[model samples]
Target chain A: MSPLFTSAHEGTLAVSAGIGLLLLAASGWVSVLHRRKPGPGTRELVLRLRAWWVICALFLGAVLAGGRVGVLLFAFISYLAFKEYVSLIPFRRVDRRALFWAYLAIPVQYAFIWTGWYGMFTIFIPVYMFLIVPMRMVSLQETKGFLATVGMIHWGLMITVFCLGHAAWLFVQPLSGFPVAGAGGVVLFLVGLTEANDIAQFLWGKSLGRRKLLPGVSPGKTWAGLCGGVLTTAVLAGLLAPLLTPLPVRVAVPIGAGIGLFGFMGDVTLSALKRDLGVKDCGGILPGHGGILDRIDSLMFTAPLFLHFLRFYYA
Target chain B: MKALGQILRSLLFLAVAKPFVALVLGVDLRGRERLPKKGPALLVANHNSHLDTLVLMTLFSVRQLPGLRPVAAGDYFLRNRLLRWFSLRLVGVIPITRNHAVSGGHPLTPCLEALDRGEMLILFPEGSRGEPEARAPFKRGVAHLAKSRQEVRVVPVCLGGTGLALPRGEALFVPRVCRLVIGEAFTWTGDTTGFMSELEDRFAALEAEIAPPPFPSHPNMT
Candidate 1:
């Protein structure tokens, strides 16, 4: 094996390319179907497939570029997520100074990942930020809405910067027992399955979904979709485990289930956020997909959980 | 020379000010369509920070910005040579004396002249920066000008978050999301006092619309 590409890494890349080709074929089929039938959902399906092509190209390109580029890519994702999150939420003029400090944490957190400093990367945002943000707000001497303002800023940092930083750490941090060369493959596996879980749930829900899973928060999710997604993702995870990570097939089953279930929770969490804020989408950065936050809400939960799971068993 | 200056001013506004506000403050403009596309109109807004004029200037279409003149304080903006040149040439600011009683000329004369020439004029009714929560009572000059030039539509605008960006006595600007709420244009139809009160009410309603909910009292902080 080359220094950059292990057999597992190569296999994951091949699977990614295969999926991309299948998506292209699916898009072509949908375009022809739309031309013949001209249905309402056909246009949206074609648009989604087109977006998937772009997303796949970017993801594979970053993964193939090696660890430094992969980590940088996730850092950029964290920045966009933070920008969208901050812009959507209501914050006062008094909170601006504190918000500046919150924005500064992005580069510093990514720096920790680049240097491979695990301890500082974990605590820099969650702990030190928790203390410094409130203290900085105190200097303004405006007590009105101080607590609420501070809490919102801190929450934004934790979810967008801190949790996403964990995904970046996965690229650079070394596990004792696992092959270091397969880090890119592990990232590909996690992102691939997590996104696949989202698509599968949506498809199953549309076809077989009758009973509402949580109608008030996320009306589209259904019990049939949940079960179908879990089964499909678990099977895929078990299949891809050997080619992506060192985890055994039996262990991969539960890990895949964890990713699917938690990914559902993250989706609903953001749904509740949008519902409370009275916004349909966070922002309009992506076409077809609502915003960066809308697309990556599931990863926020899955990344941190998967990172810890791998560390506990494999590391 | 005048044409060259106008071109430079337009370039400065387009290339520098617009992007600066968009990137730094994340300004969200609402009811922009309410602005008249082609007409002489009086725009009155609450003053909270130095950013108010720049923000208002950015909101106008490039074609309209040339005809738009903002009424500025004679004391602050015209105090020195460089400040006076920048105010007049760059933003097309018309100086109004703070103490019209002591000053020789009528404070509303330049504003009226601008409107007479079919130009759009922006006026800060409060006349100077005030605390965000409470606006200083509007001086009678805006109402007087509106009544005299009844043909010019008087539009009330309510601005929020500029004070937080560059509050009084603070040199550095803190980036905050600002909102500019452009209100409906109404014709003047009453005494100066009545018009002043109505305008003040319009500002109050807008402030209420955008104000953040009050913070709950904490045990630690009185």
Candidate 2:
């Protein structure tokens, strides 16, 4: 249990090289795959690819720099995505009072994780945020769906703050003996794998996703695409385990499967929220991407569940 | 103390109306401090729907900021006895004659007097409600008031998405999300006549200049 890695075992440099190769491979594969799909216009395609490029850059940066900086980057992404969600929902003057609590939750929840207070991070949203939000609403005495309005705020916080905050908790995990399970590596694996699954699912879904997973909420999502995405992530998890976690190939597969399934569920849940709110995206902040909520919907569900599993097994 | 009470009353109305309004039309507002706390402040807003005034009032009221007395039309607010009474007292409506002198009551005088009393006035300088496709040309009233009261700062507001909920010549109040954008206050300058004319031109040109970007985090200058 050394405090740092030996010179030969350092995965930072190789991780960068691997990422470059992965990007080149992905672009090549996507080009050949979609060559005849009647894709978006050249300008639109460039813009869409640029967003994926930024996400990849963030991924590569996280793997290179572990610990607090890694966790902070993930937290920052969550906060921006959540802001995008709230902006889209049209809140009434009475509902405006809840915003103070909603905005306040972003920093406090992350602070709990930053201090290595995992217990507080877990319940901050469900318990503290839940109580404080309703109380804030009560002060406004806004009789509207006092319950429902408070519930949506809670739910939004849960998804945006609590669930997304899980990625930050990776900093607190003890990664002394792990191979692919170092704090930095795990964050990279979880984020990269989950986002990769998203990209894979979309590609697979677009190409051969004939059967709808849930036609009412999201017509594009399909069972075949889901299976394809999970399978891809599982294989990637096995290959990247030594660099990311000490769990080895055997454990990484199951974990990757969990991320893929839950990430898909997160996407569905967010879709449901949009359905109820009658909005397409949370806000038009992201081009090629609908909104912040759209981008992090998968992370919201995957991050928290991943943290819990890691904590139960390793921490 | 009076302003405080006015804000409390406005909040109370919003608190009561939240359920009915939120159930049907969603409402969201930010950057409320843009409304002046003490002194004469002009709330110039884009007139898209008939509900713009109500939504703006609800917002200013809930902030517990000073109550806004909107400058409405002589023809609309002063049409019938019941409406005139309700508009004047309940909503604090000050009727302005259509490009002409007031028939009986004071037109700009009430607004000017309100300013002197350190009250806030919501001025819709379009003269009347506009069609959805285009915002009607702004009148010179906002410029005149700003120039006459050099000490006052005029706030520009671009309201989006209220017309779909409530259209012109419609009696019912429909439900929809409305945005009240509060830009920073700017003082009226230059020669009085020219300043007023330039102000009107600038005010009308704002919608095109702003486009559809996210609301500014710190939009208010003063």
Candidate 3:
């Protein structure tokens, strides 16, 4: 590893270049729209692009800084996402202490990632928090809405902390035998592909989508879009894997396709969540993106799946 | 030396308060442009946590912080010498007497004086922090304070989720998103009742400004 980048490697630079190309393309596309009759759509597109710039800068900077910084960033994100999820649900006064413990699990989960305790990182939230949160709630001995509340808290912890923690855990993995691109590359590969899959689906859906994927859940998603998106993402993943990962072309393409499929699942799942809650956005912190959860919901599912997949086959 | 202390106090306050508010809790501001640019202004909000004052302070520029005085209960904020010093010196709080004014002085007398000095005062009409994320009926404190000071622009702020972040009883902060919706400034129209009702209506509207839109609770709607 170079002293300048510290934890960054070939894969890190590869991911950065990919993001730069994306920005260049977006900026160029937006600039050409001025010659045509511009409207509210144009303004929104510009705002969306600007937000992407900020998101990219912050993310890549964290990755480049080293694994520790990346861990902290993901920890903060899990904290924010959990905050968004729990705030939306019905929580009583009795749940305060339990809420504290649930929140404490975020740091503890990330601490495992920081210390490279893969065993605990994977099961702590799913197994331990699953039992412990309900126990704390039971200690309060509040039975009314007890089961519902306990189930909801544990589920949220799994999604926001456990699932997202996989991405941070990627940063901590030993990259000595993996590839020259290092751990940063693996983290970037997952993020870049997941994000690209989202964009590809949106574009494909808009252009060729004649049928709704889930008419009740997401009115926008279409079958045509999903197929097109997964295909594109699979191809992109195959091309980038050689530069970024230790995976063979056969493994990489399937993982890419899996990511695309799972990414869509996460998006619609959040859509269903918002629908059930009867709210549009989780939070309005991001101008165009909604909340941190909204921006990274796809990653919430994809991160855990990819991390475990790599563990089974390669790690 | 006084000016030096003011600068030092603001530096310390900003150093400690800004990050606590910004980093730990997410703040969503609405109608922020309506916040008064200059003082002799009144910032009335619904209180739930100690963070109510801190969250409001960060909305203003650093230079204006010296003159921003949060109107807090004298008995609550000034019971001890240490608290008294911290509140008075660091927070720049103008302690409002909560007890009966047996001395025949108006309860809002000190607040009136602060406004006279062109300071921006934050008043929680609820008088005290109560339950988390629950809006208590705003007392007539704001109307009472603004009654004599007709020139001061009364900016109504609806602060939500501060309680969820650091509620009254809890010492530890569980990070949660906080919302502050600043409403259009209004004035006392010589009728305390009318002003109170108007402020009440304004808060209702501001709370709705930050509140999530109503949707069917059951999943059947989709």
Candidate 4:
């Protein structure tokens, strides 16, 4: 499996180059329209966006460094994300033994992905781990609210482990035909483009955003932010296309926008769960930030969807 | 391993009790700094809502006050599996039989032992919770403990507005503002019987100091 860039696919390269510039222009436009005049918060958002841009570039550099290094980064992301998820929803003493099993799944899931054993990785949490976890809980014979207890554990694992496992799958894909260096680059591309949408929407919403989107579910979400984020994401995806897959410029733009839109839905869904639970900030470990669950809520929804798309288009 | 077990036990208690407590319950703690910073301290608090224990945990969760154990009788907390586990392991509860004969005489050994170990023990002293703002007859347990461990700092704490949250035999915990007043610690000095009487008197004074003025409609509005 050679790097996607090894193919020197000019079509993909042109798509990435074109989309990047357009996305920048769209983001600028959204900033101008919403803020009308930028305030301190708006200025901070811009700084955050710039920081993300540098991070993406650094990650891209690592992917270009080598395949093994790229895979390591994917594994690291899964580790951090899963750590954050577990910290938010800690287990009771009776259920804590199952925690070991849950932790054991992380390495196994990534290992399966490294070996390209897609079938095993997909079923690891929902199937095998599901059976084992409940049995472990029942063996104690505590027998109080058993169903609700087990269900929460299973659900938490599904989002944190199953969804996150997809990131590792990016490495096993054969990216020899792509314009970028490796399947790892495609993973980086998808993550960067998706996260960029989050930043864009947040920035736009804080500025010129007036109309609320799904006010009951997520009071802060706004239509203006959604429009701006989608535009920006699609354009960025198109520009970055040359560094990853051989998708046409037209395809990259729309696909990025679609991912961004869906990603927003994912964020809101997680937010709804927290709101229903009547919790503010999932665990409050991060000084300014909330919890691990809060940070990765978007990825929980987007990872599986993006992976399915990858398999559909390139498999 | 034993020390680690004690801490893990506390965390387990917090984890289980967390759900029972609604996030809506708000606390406006007054005189928190008055919490004794040193040894052999007795936190004598008025009981109103059952959730008072959790509120206390939240208050002291961040700070380290050695030998800080809440005395819970076997009748209420130990009757169930979950609460028993929580009370024994996490709360460091000391079971005291209510109005039962002490076969060996001197039932205050547990209290004295705790103080000797340089730990803080919380006592209800009224033996059970009372109506909000209404004072109950103080049990001789606090007086007995003070008489045995003369060095023990007797800190009286009054909790207000808890019964409104989960009054007797209620499952639903309604959110309400709860208040806590920590009275200054005082020493007990006198003959055996007189010392116990003095202890009761000091307790009454602390109660009066913390208890709010009776409403105009109060039947016994003295």
In terms of TM-score, the best-performing candidate is: 3
Instruction: Give the per-residue lDDT of model 3 (tens digit) for B1-28.
Output: 7788798887876787777767677787
Q: Record all residue pairs in model 1 with backbone atoms less than 3 Å apart, i.e. clashing.
A: none
Ranking by DockQ: 3, 1, 2, 4
Q: lDDT of all predictions, in order shown? A: 0.81, 0.69, 0.83, 0.65
Q: By TM-score, highest first, what's the ranking?
A: 3, 1, 2, 4
User: Candidate 2 residues A96-133, lDDT tens each?
Assistant: 55765687788787778777776787778899888998
Measured with C-alpha atoms, the lDDT of residue B141 in candidate 1 is 85
* lDDT by residue for model 1 (A1-315), tens: 123333446766777778778887898899999898887688777776777777778778776665677777888788778867776666655577888788888889998888888889889988999999999999889788788878888988999989877777877867677766677778887888899899898998899999998999999999999999888889999999988788889988898999999888888999988887777877555656877889999889889988998888866
lDDT of 2 by residue, B1-222 (tens): 656645555665676555444433545444567766655788888787767777777654344334467888878778899888667655777776775543555458778988887777887777767685247767677777887898888888777657645666655443334555566678887576776566555555555443333332211101
Model 4 residue B193 CA deviation in Å? 21
Residues A24-121 of candidate 3: C-alpha lDDT, one tens digit per residue: 89888996884475888887787778888888888988776755777888898888899888777656566778889999998888888888887897
Model 1: fnat (fraction of native contacts): 0.17
Least lDDT summed over 10 consecutive residues: which range in candidate 1 chain B? B213-222
Docking class of 4: incorrect
User: Who wins the lDDT comparison?
Assistant: 3
**Second chain TM-score for model 3:** 0.92
Weakest lDDT window of 10 consecutive positions for candidate 3 chain A: A1-10
Instruction: Give the docking tier of candidate 3.
Output: acceptable
TM-scores, all models, native as reference: 0.71, 0.60, 0.93, 0.51
